[model samples]
Target chain A: MRAEEPRLDAAGALAFKDHLREAVRDAPPRVVLDLGAVDFLDSSGLGAVVAARKFVANGALELAALTPAVARVFRLTRMDSVFTIYPDVPQAIAG
Target chain B: MPRERVRFRADLHAVRDALIQLERGAVLGPLTGESRSVILLVLAEVMNNIAEHAYRGEGGEGSVCLWRKDGAVMARIVDRGLPAPAIPAATDTPNPADLPEGGFGMPLIRVLVRELAQSRRCGCNVMQLCVDDDNAA
Candidate 1:
């Protein structure tokens, strides 16, 4: 799933999560979220991404193509260790 | 010293606009790209908290003022909203195995900033954050 929004901050975190939940209602066991276009992410946005994983049911939720700003948030929170991050969507799907 | 200030309503969308205005203005323009990203991250956490917690009910207005202090970027965020809850001690990120979602905000603010201070002035909540490029990730 691609995040069309340039920013995934507090302004749209909830909506993003809700949208993800709706999109994944009948998803496969593995889901990969494409974050290449999201330039900014705060803790609220980070939480929304983490929360998106929970929406996947028994399957796993992965991430791809973190921008510099978004990468910094994950690194600072050490959330980089938590989520499976990929250089791009294809790489994420390949793994 | 060059200074810039961005003001916005308490809503979350306005918070994003304020960050963009501050990022594009002259104050952060002189900094390195990495330094600016660090500043933006710290300020985004701070402003979003105010929008979500301090002004949750009735909503209000807020402003972020930026200036240089001894080679560090200083940001003063002032909002006419409710007083903030007590700050938690600066702690390491929780065990990721827990799949934590909500507790990363304060810890990110505590880790990325060189200095953090908050107070209630008159009827507003005032937060000060210092972003030192040398120390920030």
Candidate 2:
């Protein structure tokens, strides 16, 4: 469970994306992105999630646990259906 | 027509809180479920842009106003900061593939609102957004 609060901009988006990649690099087959602390997100943040989904799709890794605001972005773009969303870290990992 | 106005420093969190207040105050009353979600998304994106880009995160001041006239919920965001770039000509549909994390703000703002107008007046960038509940029906 790697958590990051990068500056709220493109740099922050890229940092989160890199964190997602690093978390799944060892092929753990399961990952949970904890966005509870993320107060703001934009389209770039949405793209990072999409990128993470593509990265995890290659293996048995699972990505879940999107915060409400983060989940809202996925839902707004209709990408929530594409990614399995859980409410929290424990739930995501348990599933 | 009297309008409700709220002013705050250019803080991302403050902008979001103000939006939540407006949403709860019946500005988007007729919109429920998915429709409400659309309004929230658009509002957050635009407010975030103003805080991040327009004000450059330097803590400038801005005002948000919401007015209900007829069946439409109208909102105007005015910021005393750098002027935003002109609204792009092609705004109806945003290309998800070519979207940059930062540049997608204006495009998303355009699609989320029923109507959008942007201009620079008195050294302030004013963004006008409107949503008609009747259209959602």
Candidate 3:
């Protein structure tokens, strides 16, 4: 259960995408993305989450725990229905 | 009925503060949770676009001018950075699945705001966003 909130920027989006790919490389994975401290999220930021979900699905892993703003983005884009979203880290891990 | 202009850095935190102030000052009538959320989302998207693509993370300042006229809340953002690309014509419905996070900023702005305009003026990019007060109904 590894988590990180790398500094978000235009260029940081690429790094974040790579991080997601790396995180899901191992099998039987459990990952939590903490977005509570993230006050800002751009399209690139949102895309990284989507890409991560795709990676997790490939390995039969679960991805959850989206903060309010991030959850709102997923909802607006209808990705919320696609991803299993939880309010906090514990709930995400437990579920 | 005079317009008010605020200049601040193009950072995300600063833009969030500006959106909060905008809601406090401009939003009249009942402040429903949904309304507040939508306004914040719209403003944040626009500001992020200016900070990321327009300013290219160079830490420049941009101006947001707000004015109420004809029962509408109007905001104009002027930035001395890259010019905005021409917006394609609006389709009937948005395709969320195909939406790329990187390119959705301007499109999201257009969807959330009642009226949106973009142009390049004197080597600066000027974007106008408006929300109709009636939409709250």
Best by lDDT: 1
Candidate 1 vs candidate 3, lDDT winner: 1
* Candidate 1 local lDDT, A24-93, one digit each (tens): 9999988899999998888888989999999997748889999888898888888888788999988898
Question: lDDT tens string, model 3, A43-68?
Answer: 56776766666677442334455545
The deviation in Å at residue B97 for candidate 1 is 1.5
Q: Per-residue lDDT tens digits of candidate 2, residues B1-137?
A: 54667786687667756766665655554555445555656666777677788888888888888777776668888988888877775654334444323355566666556778898999999988887654432
TM-score of chain B of each: 0.93, 0.79, 0.77
Candidate rank order under TM-score: 1, 2, 3
DockQ of predictions, in order shown: 0.78, 0.22, 0.26
| Candidate order, DockQ descending | 1, 3, 2
TM-score each candidate.
Answer: 0.92, 0.65, 0.65
How much is B52 displaced in model 1, in angstroms? Answer: 1.8
Off by over 4 Å in 1: B86-89
lDDT score, candidate 1, position B124 = 88
Winning model by DockQ: 1
Q: Write the per-residue lDDT of candidate 1 for residues B75-122, one digit (tens) a residue.
A: 999998888975665677777778888888778878888787888999
